[model samples]
Target: MIWSVISLLMPFNLEVMVNQGYLAERSGYWGFLLQHPLNSLFEGGLVHLWFLPALMIAVAIMALLIRQQKTHWMLPIAIGLYLYGEFAGSSAVVTGMSAPIYTRNGPFFSTLFVVVGYLIRERHILWQSRSALLLAMLGMAFHFVEAYGLHQYGQVFNTNDYLFGTTLWAIGLFLFLLAKPDLGRKPWGFSLSQSILGFYVSHLLVVIMMMNLARFLGLAGLEKDTLVLFGTLLTTYLLVKGLERTPLKHLLFR
Candidate 1:
C-alpha cells in the first residue's frame, strides 16, 4: 500500500523495462506491475511489489499442506509447479509463444523456495560451509550450461527468468548464508544488512529519478547502470540511516 502510493510519485511509467521493447507483452501488464489495483498487486501489479503477493500465496499453500499432514508432498508439488511456471512463462524460448498470464507472478517461483526454507526449519537440516559451497558452485555451473543450451538449441539467446539451475542456485546460496551466521557482523556490514530491505523497496524510485535526471543533464553515458547502481546505493543508504532513527521508520522503512 505504501509502495502503491509512493511509487506513483516517480516517473515509473517511463521505466526502462517497459520502454526497452523486449517485454512488450509484459509492458501492457505494467512494464512491470505497470498494473491493476490493490487486489491484484501480487500479479506484478506494482512491478517489484510482486514478491509480497507471491510470498504470501506460497506460504499459504505451504500452510495448507502442513495442516493436512501432506508435508511429504511439498517439495514434489513445488517442483511440479515451478516447472509449469517456467515453461508457461519462458515457452517462447522453445515454442515461440507466450502464455497469457505471467507465470512468474504466480505461485510457481515462490512455492519451491518457500517450501524448501520451511522444510529446512521443520526438519532441522544443517549444512556445512564446504558442502554448501560445493552445491553453490555446481548450481552456478548449471546456469552456464543451461544458458549455453538455450543459445545453441532453444529459440532464443537467453532464457526467461529461471532455468532449472536457478532454484538450485538460490537454495545453495541460502544455505551458504545460513552456514555463516556471523559472516557480516562488522559495523558497516551490519548497517548494510539492516538497510537492505530499505534499499530494495526504495531503489526503484531512486533509479527512476536518477535516470530522468541523467537524461536531462545529457549524462546518459556517465549515468549508465553501474553509475546508477552506486548512486542508488548511496542515496538509499543515507535515507535509511536517517529513517532508522525516526518513528516513520516503522511505517516507511524499517
Candidate 2:
C-alpha cells in the first residue's frame, strides 16, 4: 500500500520520466500536488486540480468505513475505482479527452495490473496456458508499431497516442488475463523492485543533471532537446553506479 501510494504520486512530478516520455501529462497532477500540497487538497485552475487526491482520500475513508463494518465488496470497489477511474480518466483528462488509451498518467490503472500480480502470487495462474504469452507477443508487436509511428509523426505524437494506448491496453489486458498462471512463481528470476529503484533514482539523477546542463549550455531548439536525452541516459548510468555504494541504497531498494 505504501508503494502503491508512492507509485500513485510518482507521475505528478517526475521530471525525470517526463523527459523519457513516460508520464509527461500526468506530471501536471504531481506537480500541482508538490507545489501546493494544501491547495491540492481542494482544487486549482483550468489545468490539474485536487479531484484526484480528493478521490483517493474519499476512497481511503470509505475503505475505513467498510473495514469498520467488515465488508468485502468495498475492497474490490475501492480498489477498482482507484484503478479504473485513474486508468480511464488519466489518458482522457491529460490529452483533453482526445486520447483515451495511453497509460501516461500515473500507476492508477496500473494498480489493477499490480493487483492481478498479487493474484498471480496467490493463485498460480500463468502456467495454465500459452494464450497469455501469445497475446503479450502480439501486443508487443503493436506497441512497437505505435511507438514507431509516434517517432515518425514527431510533433503530432499527442494526436496519435490513442494508437499507443490501444497497443498498451492490448498488452496490459493480456498480461492480466495470464496473471492467474504466470505471475506467482516461487523463485523469481530477477528483482523487479530492485530494477525499479535503479531505474527510478538513476533516471531522476539524469534529469536533474541534464536540466542544469541545458541551462548552462543555452542550447536552444532541437539541440537542447537532443542533449537532454543524451545527458539523462549518461547520468543515469553514472548515478546508478555511484549510488550502489552509498547509504542511500536502502532509499532506492527499500
Candidate 3:
C-alpha cells in the first residue's frame, strides 16, 4: 500500500501517458495523488493494486470457510459462482445489462481462484505428472478458443472467460511447478523473490517513462515495447536491491 501510494504520487500518469495526445488534460501531481486513494480502494488503483484487495477478500472468505469445516463444499460453491458469473455475462444481451459485472466485482470474481489455490494447498495436489501437463496444455488451448469466440461475438472478453479455461491453465502450470524439485534454488532466487513486490509496484512507472523516452527517440511498435519491458525490469531490480539495504526498506516494502 505504501509503495502503491508513493508510485501514484510520481509525476507519471498512466491515463495521460497512454493517451499521448491528451497530455494537456493530465491531472496535476497533487490532485492525482489526492484522488488516488479513493480510486485505488474502489477501482483497483495504480494498475495492479486491485489484486491486493481482491486477494485479501478472497483469502478472508476462504479462511472463514475453512474455520467452519466447510472445505469440502468450497470448491463446488466456487464453481457454481463462477458459472453464474459466466451466465450473467451471456445474459447481458437479453437483459440489456452490462455483461462484465463479475469482472468489475473483484471480490466475487477472485473467489474461484482463491478457492482453487486453497484446495490445492490443502490436498497437496502435485502437478508433475504427464496427465497434468497434457491437461494444462489443453486448458490453455481452450482458453484461447474461448477468448477468440468472445471476440467474434462482439462481446468484451472478461474475467468470467478467464475463470473458465484460464483457471485450468493456471492450475496445471502451478502443479507442473510443484512437481519440479529444484525450481527455486537459483543463486538469484532469494533476491529476486524479495524484490518482486517492489518490482510489481514500480514497474508501471518505469514502463511509462521508458515508453515516452522510446517515442521521443523515434522508436515504435515492438521496439518501443521491448525497450519499455527490459528497461523497466532492469531499473526496478536495481531500485529494489538498493532499497533493500536502506532504512526506507521497512516503509517501502514491509
Per residue, candidate 3 scores C-alpha lDDT tens digits across 1-254 of 77556555555644464666334434554455455454445434366666677778778877888899888887777777666655566434433544333343455557888898777887888764676777789899888787667666566666333536777787787777778758788878975887877777767777878976886788998998889889888887888888889998888777
Model 1, 230: alpha-carbon shift in Å?
2.3
Q: Model 1 misses residue 146 by how many Å? A: 1.1
Can you rank all candidates by lDDT, best first?
A: 1, 3, 2
Clashing pairs in 3: 127-175
lDDT of 2 by residue, 1-254 (tens): 22334444444334455566656645655675567544433432212223344445555554565568744444475365444543344333343433222232333343343444444555655542356556656666775565565455342434432343343455455555565544545444243334545765346435646766776677887888888888887766666667677986676545
How does candidate 3 fare on TM-score?
Answer: 0.79
Error of 2 at 46 (Å): 20
Question: Which of 1 and 3 is ahead in TM-score?
Answer: 1
Minimal lDDT window, size 10, model 2: 42-51
Report the alpha-carbon TM-score of model 1 versus the true structure. Answer: 0.80
Task: Give the least accurate 10-residue stretch of model 3, judged by summed lDDT.
Answer: 93-102
Candidate 2 residue 31 Cα shift, in angstroms, is: 10
- Output the lDDT of residue 13, model 3: 44
Which residues of candidate 3, in runs, are more than 4 Å off? 13-42, 87-105, 156-163
Residue 54 error, candidate 3, Å: 1.3
lDDT string, candidate 1, 48-114, tens digits: 7667778888999999998999989999999998888877666446655454556777688899999
